[model samples]
Target: MSTSVGEAVVGVILAGGMASRMGGGDKPLFTLAGRPMLDSVLERLAPQCSRMVLSANGDPARFANYGLPVVADPVTGFVGPLAGILAGMDWAARELPAAELIATVPGDCPFLPRDLVSRLSEARRAQVADIALAASGGRTHNVVGLWPVALRDHLRQAIVAERLRKVALWTSRYRTVSVPWVEGPIDPFLNVNSPGDLEEAERLARMLES
Candidate 1:
């Protein structure tokens, strides 16, 4: 299942989290290096993907300015990222029929490498994997992945039946491959979860800029 550079891939930002540890505010909209985190994610992913959609569970108006379609979890009630992934798959299936894969990244991960989609796609093709996860510093970053759109039905069934909610659990059921990004100054997949993490990300950004 080889994919060309121009082949359509839908990029999805999972922004629906309750951000319980971040004091219940929107994680994606948090400031990092003087810009919204979602802005950074979109800027990095826009060129890698042919089209983009946001998986968020709040008022769509907040993200409407981005001009990308905003989709909510069909299962509702903040059921975690699996719901967001399912919503993304459904969107790709209908809007971008040519999209064979949906590449996802957490909106809170401001430092995601620009080559994320390409690297994951390469891993998927190399291993003939149904899903590709990103790894850095010997740890798996499951949310950052390229998933075959064909898995939509299975995911939907799982979510609807309350069978599969955890992303790692779902990936374990598939032919999964890991794309290694081991040569960066920091973990390219670094996510900002707490205030301390936000400060750390800021520090890393400064170092990268120098």
Candidate 2:
């Protein structure tokens, strides 16, 4: 998917998770550096997308202040991030008809690069890939990816009948391309999954400032 400025590239923040590890609180709403974690994620992704949506299972009103549409998993029972991705694809197919691809980023990944969408989109286009994933330190970050909306049916089938919803597994079925973001002082794809991770993110943020 070749995405130019102003083109219809939908950004989906995957927030539909049970943050059991971090004491069961909403991970995205958790504060990092005196700001909601989602705020930093949205700040990085919003500029690169034509429209943005939050995929959360809980009440959408909680995210009303963000002024972005919050989508719940159409298929219930708390299925994984794949459910969120499917929801995003469905939303893009229905609402943003012109959108060719849905770019997904985890809500806890506050350090995602600002050029994430552009880089992934360009990689997908160059490689003629159906899915484009991010990589840091030689590890593929499958959740941070861009998926073609055209594969909506295949995804839905995989989720419904087979109960196979892992992002990496589904992505492997397609012509997937990985875009490398070489390591630096701060790994751009650092995700805060626990309290300790939040603390580390703060330290990294300070390091960036210094």
Candidate 3:
């Protein structure tokens, strides 16, 4: 996927989830307001990155309409977002030679902040951190953060050799920083994990578009 954001960061949308609470379907594809939640995610994220890719683990054809290169988790057996992030890192390293960093977000968060990449990148640079994460309402959204493409090999070893599935655990080894975001009419990092969350997102969508 070719992006024109002029920044050397690739966006990774982690879409590979069981979504058991949503009845085992692609939660990102679920309609939020009148469009797919992933549509809203892409709308907010695309302009902040050099390009984007979808990290998923199913039949990729279902996401063909989104026009992103779908990458499956490098480590299988329901490892979690770290695997997806690794796949994204690998993809960025291989496909986007100029990309030095990757900004990752959960697929279900439709209203993620447009300044996410900028804030994370800025904080990472200022703090001289290896990674930077998003925080809101005093809670860190671990998966929504910036990672260095140069650490892809280390991440791979953590996933493959160490069998690490928890994102926080893996990130703890690095000099990570947090960039807090203020919540307003909507929490920019809100995730639609269940039908109830989807309903809330539906309500927030109208407010966002208004």
What are the clash counts of all predictions, listed in order?
Answer: 0, 0, 0
Provide the clash count, candidate 3.
Answer: 0
Per-residue lDDT tens digits of candidate 3, residues 81-105?
9999999999999998899989999
In model 2, which regions exceed 4 Å deviation?
A: 1-6
TM-score of each: 0.95, 0.96, 0.96
In candidate 2, which residue pairs get closer than 3 Å at backbone N, Cα or C atoms, i.e. clash?
none
Model 2 TM-score, 2 decimals: 0.96
Those runs of model 1 whose alpha carbons end farther than 4 Å from true positions after fitting are 1-4
Off by over 4 Å in 3: 1-6
Q: Is candidate 1 or candidate 2 better by TM-score?
A: 2
Of the candidates numbered 1 and 3, which has the greater TM-score value? 3
lDDT of 2: 0.88
- For model 1, what is the C-alpha lDDT against the true structure? 0.86
RMSD of 2: 2.0
Score each candidate by Cα lDDT: 0.86, 0.88, 0.89
